[model samples]
Target: MKGKRVALLALFAAVLAAVAIEPAAAQSGADSTTEKLIWDLNNQLMYIAVPITVLVEAILFYTVWKFKNNESPLPTRENRRLEITWTVATAVILLFVGVASYQVLAEPYVTATGADAGVDTVAEDEEILDVQVTAQKYNWQFNYPEQGVTNANTLVLPTDRPVRLNVTSTDWLHAFHVPGMGLKTDAFPGQSNYLLTKPTDTGEYQLYCAEYCGVGHSQMLGTVEVRSQDEFQSWLAENGDSGGDTASGNETAGNETGALSP
Candidate 1:
């Protein structure tokens, strides 16, 4: 019994330590409004979850410690009050999770679907840059439909402005993920998925294909370069025609499965 008690205490301590260290480890270096929102949501959930976890673990440990020596323990009596209390608490927690998740998912910058397709709801006066993202076996292509510019393996966007990414896969299914910006969406073949975000900082962020495609899945990596509006416009003008041809040629040569062109 003493050994069991010691093990339980150690487990309780480990749980507490894990809860304490989770926030720091979970940080993704959010640098955009949508990313910040996601970060905030994670913290919110942690705040709620930590306390409940502690409470439940504490009760479990206490019960074990208190009843450990009872060799001829009596049958437990049912307590309606305790039962009702826990049931209500569980319902409330579930409700909170549902509402919080829905709030984040329903945001225009997080997801734009149904009747809100192609609509810029982030700001009325702000201009939204539309970029089409195409994923193949081992590469990514970002095309600015309005500017008639395209780039391979690198996505460029203007800071402080909303960006709409129409993501799709040319061959196999892939996922477009920018961890720093909290942007992730499935890129299905023949279907375009929209993801919206506003960059709050000017820096290079890492992009990855979150799904497994083929032998080259590990190499299916990309970069997101966020720059000032003026610099972004300059880059568009410089690469408007040349960039498209270069990206097309590179993709055509690199494509092993003969996927459809972006």
Candidate 2:
């Protein structure tokens, strides 16, 4: 009877541990290609670092315990083979990390095109949805020049479709960062930056200003709504302004044309 109670308690403890650990392991991600690559690199580096950290700590503790309170200690000779082995091992590990990082960066999904450089890789295709982003003191304005729509603090996107954003600031510097989409670009005054992404899931994601601008920086918040292609078209039709080109048209034209002014 006593043995059975102890076994039950141990099983209960194991169940509790698993429950506690599962949520931490299942943290949400950006649900995009760029974020997946970054997370893969992070997990791989942790796998490589954890064992080395444990081994070094074990060696340090053992050395301290073995030589505790020793008045006289004999001189220890260092082995040349050990030194060479560690050096070579470290070099090989670094080489592996560098190669892996380079491969991820080389993918076509991650790219940066200057303001006046060639057409944006993502935007070059005819099927792309272009949204011009304007950043100010504490707000973000998203303009769909093609659809003739201007939305403030809310960016709407169509799922499963490629999106290209032209980002620039009017007053101060800001960073347009959407963690769920794994897209971030700087909003510089008089200069344009670009970011491309495709949201696979249909949900609302949070957007934030990654750079600190002023006192209202903490309140610089926005939302990105991902909808189906049909729903997106319907939204554009309903909310779009017909007469005025509220969204400045800068694509395929001069760079200074589409500055989102007040």
Would you list the clashing residue pairs of candidate 2?
A: none
What is the TM-score of candidate 2?
0.74
What tens-digit string does per-residue lDDT give for candidate 1 at 69-185?
Answer: 999999879999999998999999999999998998788777767324436466678877889999988889988888999898889999998888889988889999988888999
Candidate No. with top TM-score: 1
Give the total clashing residue pairs for model 2.
0
> Best candidate per lDDT, number?
1
Candidate 2 — which residues are off by over 4 angstroms?
Answer: 1-26, 114-126, 242-262
Report lDDT (CA) for all predictions: 0.82, 0.72
Stretches of candidate 1 above 4 Å error? 1-29, 114-120, 256-262
Q: What tens-digit string does per-residue lDDT give for candidate 2 at 27-112?
A: 74546656666676765665566556555655666567768988798897988999999999999989988988887666545554
Q: What lDDT score is found at residue 108 in candidate 2?
A: 42
Query: Each model's TM-score, in the order given?
Result: 0.83, 0.74
Lowest-sum lDDT 10-residue window in model 2: 250-259
